[model samples]
Target: MSTGRLIAAYIFGSVGRGQADALSDLDILAVVENNLGKVAELDVIKLVPLQFASLKPSISWYGAARVAEMFQNGELFAWHLSRETVSLFDPNKFLQTLGTPAPYKECLADVRSFRAILSGIPPQVQQSAVNAAYEAGLVYVCLRNIAMAASWELCEAPDFSRYSVFNLSGLRKCPISVEEFDAAMHCRMASQRGLQPPHTATVSYILGIYSRLDPWLDELEELLLRKENGRQYAQNAV
Candidate 1:
């Protein structure tokens, strides 16, 4: 069972949240005494049962101390674990003892990082047939992560839902329509499932989605700035 070196193990993400479908891949974490941070797949893939190998569970390996540090720092990864992890193996209840993570404080920084990635992708890169689906996937991930981080910055509990983008405070000001965002989401999921239609206009559709991301990011940035300023104002007044 490899329990000698393994300290904690759990499933997280969609499956942890009970939002997964038949097509969803498992997100697993294995905390080992030997590895302190990220470990290679081969280091832990064999620990998974052969029956579940076909599902291709995405596994992560970390050292116990590293997990403690992440929890102490209140990173987004910490919040995710605190909010949505179901224990598969926890003889010592290590994760349970870690308790709630510190408040996430890098919301704006993360949003800006996501913005940089989108900008760096260049229009030509996004338009390429080879990168169209990949670009859409990146956008989907960025929007979801932005929403989660922004929620913490807004003094709200983090929103980790698949559709978290639509749930942000200033989401009404977001330029992207629900339908357009959803189209990209479907494309991302389809790509993950290796589904390519005989005839598809993925390039054109992803470009259209790209057009709206700029204004959407602008809206999020403005909202986050306002919140930060409001906090500063209250602090200065006191």
Candidate 2:
């Protein structure tokens, strides 16, 4: 629990207080009374980006009892309960008390839904939108996809807008190749009309990575759509 407190105390915005529904950046505190009449405090901190869509960070804080109160009183606790890839401090017993594991299949379903939304983005927008618009949207959409995947797998979610992960060296291991991402960036940049392709060779290198990453998602996509079609077919059969 002290690790949770330390995370809440030291990590700028990880612990979110006040909002029953925790947003991107939050500091949360948990306080309980011991048999000895001493108060034990647990803090959980999380860093979430500002925009519901954007990948920017913000700060917030709260105590554990308050978080429990909110969960009892509000719908937002559902979000907290749903998160699987959280960086827990003093995770030992408190997490186990939170109860049975959530079905990861549900989280994967959410990821597949998010991917569908992304796939719906018009190719025309990809071809013509200004660089900033594309980058902004890309940061949101791509990171959400990545986050949902990590959440489903109960793995750490990378902060892609952060240079440490989104940069050339980092994305080499990502599902989307650095080359395709760069090409996408280039195409968006060149959509402005006067610029020449600055990094053609790198784009090909990236595309090669995309070739590897893209197919792996096929099963996820199929699982998602099959479920959807089944639901619809069942409705019609009814």
Candidate 3:
């Protein structure tokens, strides 16, 4: 099996199909037998969970076998093991191969910056856009840190539906449009076997605090994307 496909099978086999979320990253660890000289072929595949028809999965392969070798030796593992990973699947053997831990000061800074942003928004605006997404980000970061401390291979995405188990499901459902709401509710009922009114007002109360106390949330999103992409670019440069 191809490297990427092999990893997907493991994720689906271990975590069950359809468990990954839109924001989840796929962390694949492949071992090449006998230090194969100048090996070339490697692949990765990602699929959006639902309703992301036009988005294509991001794929990357190292042109240099040296890069692949270093990666397998854990040179690039720290980035994945950072405070951003919410692991979906990581094998036992691979877990034993963990490299040295990276200091998460940078990660903590980003998290603190995001929380700081939450404090600068207006009260009314906080009641809407700012609250829900900010709280989601906080939930995501906390989960990411927890996953890292556990030594699991961290995929940089959180499974929101999985995240729902933390009482954030209702919070995730808060941002839906009428159509989105109906669909999400349908899925919720199908999965849970009953209709339950979302904790809209409750989520709002928590998110409201985050929103009003923060800066515009969009700025934080852009900052995180830039930082994450920058980290990937740095890793690729290694």
What are the lDDT scores of the predictions, listed in order?
Answer: 0.74, 0.40, 0.35
lDDT (0-100) at residue 27 of candidate 3? 34
Q: Worst 10-residue stretch by lDDT in candidate 1? A: 197-206
- Using lDDT, give the best candidate's number: 1
Q: How many clashes (backbone atoms < 3 Å, residues ≥3 apart in a chain or on different chains) does model 2 have? A: 27
Tens digits of per-residue lDDT, candidate 2, 1-238, equal 2323331222222222222222233333333322222223311213232332242332234455544454444322333443422333443454334454333334445555655655444443445443334443343445345443433333343222222224222123346545455555554445444455444423234334444545545644554456557866999999
**Per-residue lDDT over 1-238 for candidate 1, one digit per residue giving the tens place of the 0 to 100 score:** 2333768788888878988776568889888885444445565566555645676587777888889999999899998999898777789999889998887778889999888777755475554677766677777777777778887865367878777777777556456777776666766777777876223336676566667677768877988888888988999999
User: Per-candidate RMSD vs. true structure?
Assistant: 3.7, 12.7, 13.4
Clashing pairs in 1: none
Best by TM-score: 1
lDDT of 1 at 57: 84
What's the distance in Å from true for residue 49, model 3? 17
Q: Rank the candidates by lDDT, best first.
A: 1, 2, 3
After superposition of all CA atoms, the RMSD between model 2 and the true structure is 12.7
Model 2 is weakest, by summed lDDT over 10 consecutive residues, at: 162-171
User: Could you tell me the TM-score of candidate 3?
Assistant: 0.29
